[model samples]
Target: MENARSGNAGKHKTRASIVEVAARLLHEQGTAAVTTRAVAQAAGMQAPTIYRFFEDKDALLDAVAQHVFTTYVAGKRLVEDSDDPVADLRAGWDAHIGFGLANAALFGLLTDPNRGTRSPAAAAGLEILRARVRRIAAIGRLRVTERRAVELIHAAGTGAVLTLLSSPPQDRDLGLADAMYEAVMRQILTDAPALPADGTTAATVAFRAIAPKLPMLTDAERTLLSEWLNRAGDDPASFDASHRRG
Candidate 1:
């Protein structure tokens, strides 16, 4: 048992070290520097050893991206939410923008549709955004459905980073992210929870946040209610049919 445990620990250590080296290479010299040979040499291991933990260069790159994003998510999850959900949401946005700008190569890898869409780390990041948007909806401040609010914030953040990155570092418009955030907020938020006066949109969003927790409803009933609520929450007042993402 002791020998087996030692072997397992050693394997875990080797994999972690390889991933660490690859992540450093990616950050310092971009994706081309993260090849299996480069990583193995940097990690002081044979290239074939990388195959024991990862199938190929793509898998190696995936692990590197995963490790980098997982570290960011760990720290992000530790931030305590304040009494003000909007303030918390803006904090998250700023952190996301800073992370993207700092880890340009990793951000590029994780935003590539073919890889980003398939990454668990990216999905976890999106879940964090969903929770932030859900809080605003629960407070009745959101004018759009939770899904729409999340989508708008995500799209804007990505665009903000890409636009900033396109410019020379010395010439980048740092305030564009703030401007984009305000634009999205204008579209998705109200002055406050106006309920019956602001009408069904905010009410539907607030209710949608708690729909699954209605203990009196059966599972099937809750599912059906959620479907209806989703339709209503994304109704004409909340969603414009013409602006859907491609």
Candidate 2:
């Protein structure tokens, strides 16, 4: 048992070392420089040794991308939530834009449709955005459903990054990201948190956020409330028409 444990630990260490080395090559020299031979040479290992841990070059690149992105996501998660959830959301957006600009090569890999569609790291990032949007919804400030808010933010961020990256650094508009963020905010957020004391849309969005957690209700009641709130949140007109006859 001791020997088996030691062997597994050794394998983990070797794999991590290889991944770190590949990640460095990918960063310092871009994706094309991360071939198995280059990574093995950098790690001071035999090329065949890489095959023991990774199936192929693509597999190694995937692991490297995961490693690099996991570090970034961890940093994003470490930020403490402030009193203003809207501010927190804006901070997260800024952090994402900064990361994309700093890690251009990794960003390309992450945005590749072929790989991104199945990337756990990409999914993790999206989940973080959802959490941020959920907080805004809970505060009665979101004008849209949580899903729509997330999609709009994600699309805006991607477009902002790609547009900035396409330009020369000196020629790039420094205000583009902030402008895009403001545009998304205008589309998704209300005037202020709970400002209109009698606003239906804000209250409906807030209620939808907390409906499931209302302990006074049974599971069936909660489910029904959720469905109604979903309708109300997604389309207020449909919600009104559906209940008008009743």
Candidate 3:
């Protein structure tokens, strides 16, 4: 029993080590740079050993998503004490941006269309994200629909961060960037006709507006949503359409 436990521990450690090294390579050099042969070399393991842990490139990329969501986005929380819906929204916004900036590579993989919907790891990661959105909605502060509010708030904030990351040197200013973020957020919270606050708490108001329309998704639909959410990192069009049409 002791030997068996020791062997399992060693296998776990090796798998973890591969994931760490692969994540670094993907983040630093992008997914294309993280070939099985290259990752094996970097991990100081043979190619076949790497294959033992992951079925294929997609599987490894899914593991990369796992690392990003688990290590970074998973622990994110906002507005722990604030009852103000606006304040809670802002806190959630900031946390979302911070996570993207901190984990650009994993963010990239999560967004890649080619990554597809094969890996269980990616599916699990999306479930974690969905729970976080639910929590943010439960904060009882915002007047917009809970899921839509969560989606819009995140799209605006993280969209801005993506812009900054992709910006040219001459166009980047952190202070001005933050100001722009604040302005966009205010408009999103107050200006949208679809998400008006009519004498109710922001969260409740928002939830009510969107509750009837929230997609009655099958399990496959949920998986598709995960893929779409990640893809929205590059283009918000599909995600926007889904929310509006749903």
What would the per-residue lDDT of candidate 2 be over residues 1-246, giving only the tens digit for each residue? 999999999999999999999988888889999999999999999999999999998899889889999888888888889988999999999998998898888888888887777888889889898888888889889888888899999999988998998998899896999999999899989887755455456678888887777889999888888887888877877877877865
Q: What tens-digit string does per-residue lDDT give for candidate 1 at 1-246?
A: 999999999999999999999999999999999888899899998999999999989988988899999999989899989999999999999999999999999999998998899988899999999999988888889888888889999999999998898888899889999999999999999998856766777887888887777799998899877776776676743333422421
| Residue-level lDDT for 136 in candidate 3 | 46
Lowest-sum lDDT 10-residue window in model 3: 191-200
Residue 202 Cα positional deviation in candidate 2, in Å, after optimal superposition: 3.2
By summed lDDT, which 10 consecutive residues of candidate 1 come out lowest? 237-246
Give the TM-score ranking, best first: 2, 1, 3
TM accuracy, model 3: 0.63
Report the lDDT tens digits of candidate 3 across residue range 1-246.
Answer: 999999999999999998889988987887788899999999998999999999998788788777666565345432153545445445655666666666666666655556625545445544544444444444433334445544554556656777766866467665654785676556435433223234334534434334445679677766675555444433445655666786
In model 2, the runs with Cα more than 4 Å from the true position are 194-199
Model 3 scores a C-alpha lDDT of 0.61
- Which residue pairs show collisions in model 2? none
